[model samples]
Target: MQKLLASCIFFMLLAFGSCTQESDTPILVSTEDLLFVGGDKVRISGRLLTNQDVLATDHGFLFSTESSFAGAQTLSLGQKNGPGRFIGESTGFKIGQTYFAKAFAEINGQRIEGDVVELKTLTPSVSSFTPTYASAGNEMVIQGKNFPQGTKVFFGTQEAQVLQNLFESKLTIRIPVAAGQVVVPVKLVIQDKEIVLPQPFEYQAGKYTKVSEFPAQARIYDNTFFTNSSGFHVGLGRLRLSDSYRSFQRFDPTNGTWTEINFPGNPRRFAFASSSYLGGGALEVDRDVFQFDRSFYKINGSSFERLPDLPFNTREAMAVDWNGKLFLFGGRDGAGSVVREYDAIGRTWSQKRPAPFDMSGTTAVFKYGERIYVLAASGQVWEYLPSQDSWLTRGTYPGNTGQGFPFAQVIGKKAYLGLYRRTQEIWELDLETGVWKSKNQIIGLPQSINAGHFQSNGMIYILRSAEESTNGVLPMELYKFEPDAI
Candidate 1:
């Protein structure tokens, strides 16, 4: 009897060890992300350990997992003709609904599971939220939440603002600017509800602050703070945390940090820019562009307004406000060239000038003694003096630069530039002597191929690259730099 019991225990331990070995292999064919917001797709791809075998789901996305879940997803499967390539689709997937999924195959009668993925379907939305009657221009901020990004918002007759529009349980809109108390039944054509403030606000003057010695193109606002690509306010001292997307996160200098209120926009898009102006001896700030859906909205520190279009689409270009005029320059586009100038005062794009020779991997900021100083991809620098109205060649970038540039912006008197391809080093510019300096040797940057990358101010941002670069790194969350000693 004792011998028989010991044998049974031995077999059980062996079986468990085999199971652990199978789970250790990470060979998987999967979508880009496990859980997806509505209207997003997950790219299912991976390898199957060279020889083994390949199996995919044919019906709904159904897979068993100990951890991780993708709501309900419709999934299909296919084989790899290449090394680790896979093909498949999740069937009957709603846009914003969430679900979990996994891939597995039976080998020698034992089932093996792959990576766990999750997905979410988009929620239904009320398309229109309009106000009628009374005054205040029938203004309404049709508060729409949990809806897919492309879902539209409408006010009475006009289409509601999109792209760079605020998201959350609340979104404000100006109907037509009316006079008295207006009552318009809130209606939504594509969303869940029309958002009307329970108590309408009376038009009143706003109080702002005056900030100086900051970079013009680097983002300076008096009574205002900047928003991240996420379209939320990085309320200076309010939110002790700062976003790498914005040049300088305006904070309450008196308190140090404040709770950041996320502005309702995609932080990854380049459509957002800020400027500061003096009004009645006070400094005022506003964001004039939101690039995601091509919407141009202006907002003071307290509220927002829909503004007009930029002279042209620009990424990596910096905006400067001077004597009531705006200047923009030094960023890449699909065609690959930095913008020279956009006379917002004249509403025109001046003839393209000699932008930074290396258009990509560049940054620009307004310096005290010069126009706007430009940093280039190859560690090159240029100065734009508005008074001279010409581009001056400056010193070379002092740090590592990449040709696959993503973003670069300035803060305070300093300028920061990020290299594309997710390299850890960031190049900076010294406003005092017009010299380039490299700050922070990012040690923990994610290893990815083709992925999102950006840089700004004192912070350095690197991310998990979804695609392959020289290294096989997967895309993940954004990484902030913690300098070693420099």
Candidate 2:
């Protein structure tokens, strides 16, 4: 019985040893994972396993377009010692194409391969483009990943000029011509596949129509303009030195014509005016001789009803109306820092808090909602709460406030500002957010100065006069500006 048991144990041990020999390998290679994939490159992670320490004569990876490893390209790592994890990288692959890869190890004289892995190179993609609004020849940047060579970009049907491509990612391009369209879609084509950008690109949109020339054929400077349901009125300014014009005219949009309106006041210049009130300008007593006019008046239809003269001899003051009261800010001739309030209902004037800076004819002021904004010469925008009679710095103006005299016209929630004297640049300010965006420069003489600006029916009308040093007679052209028109 003992001898038979021994013989059985020996047979069992022999069988076990044979099974182990059939299953075990000296050096086993496995394709573990794909580290990374790019438009033309890939990184492969692999591992070598062994029951005992072993040396491989050569090891690395094999890549092929076929799954059967036919006509494969070899990436030989030469030799490796022991069993562990290894990584290999390869490039020069076609983008958006599928390829097969596997890890390999040469043991003794025989080559062994791991499991095959399927990899597809990434295609080009677009995440975003900057300067949502741009004009022809403007530089725009596109940000994304896996951008391959020979990638084409299009703005609508027009192809944009690609300036630079950095690291197969960011693309800098020059905007194409507008192609007579205001807004266009951006598209990218890579490897015969097209991708439309998420957001449509808008060409700089602003339409300026020459409505008419100043009716008098003379440029008015230091003028006061106001708008009401009656019409757009212009009065109280000098057509030339010492020759102030008291000829108030109204431009009727319905008739598209200008007609004379009666204003019972002395010939004045540098007056403060608003939709509701007009007052406090310098009266031209003689040639180049002036005296501060303390006269004040309230508008009723096409005429002005006289009111008691202002206590202060204010001229060129920034006047705005809010909550049925007129708030007069710093004036160049009178107190340059005092804030005066007038109640139209009570027919009384009272003094309020002082302004932060000196005000003049060129100070840009506008009202939106319950607040009033003043653009200072320093490019800083200050806000004033009429109810609280307090002031706070809002933000900085981005455009050049060249020589001040920047004019603003509010339509809805947006205020279009920045036609600073001699500059054609215009910017749109969102009164709700205090954010600003640039619009197309006015298509007019940059040497001209903005004499007055007013809005009607969501459209802005700009009056530009020639500079004092201009040689030819430049007409005070009236331009109808459509801020959002293409």
Strongest candidate by TM-score:
2
Give lDDT for model 1: 0.41
Candidate 2 lDDT (Cα, 0 to 1): 0.83
RMSD of each: 28.4, 9.0
- Expressed as tens digits, the lDDT of each residue in 18-97 for candidate 1 is 67765443332232233323333333432333223334322123532224443323354522232243444443444444
After superposition, candidate 2 runs with Cα above 4 Å error: 1-94, 100-119, 126-129, 179-185, 198-202, 284-289
Instruction: State TM-scores per candidate.
Output: 0.35, 0.76
Best by lDDT: 2
Per-residue lDDT, model 1, residue 213, is 18
Provide the overall lDDT of each model, using Cα atoms, as 2-decimal numbers. Answer: 0.41, 0.83
Give candidate 1's root-mean-square deviation (CA, Å): 28.4
Tens-place lDDT per residue, model 2, 1-486, is 322443355456546655677444344577878889988788897777664567789999999999988999888887889877789988878888999999999987988788788999998777878988878899999999998666789999999988988988999999998877777889988766788988889887778888988785877777888888888888768875447777787888777899888778887888988888999888667676669888999887578999988887887898887888898988774577788899888788999888888777767888888899888766788888988989999898899888888888889999888888768898988888988888888887778888777888878998888786786867788899998886
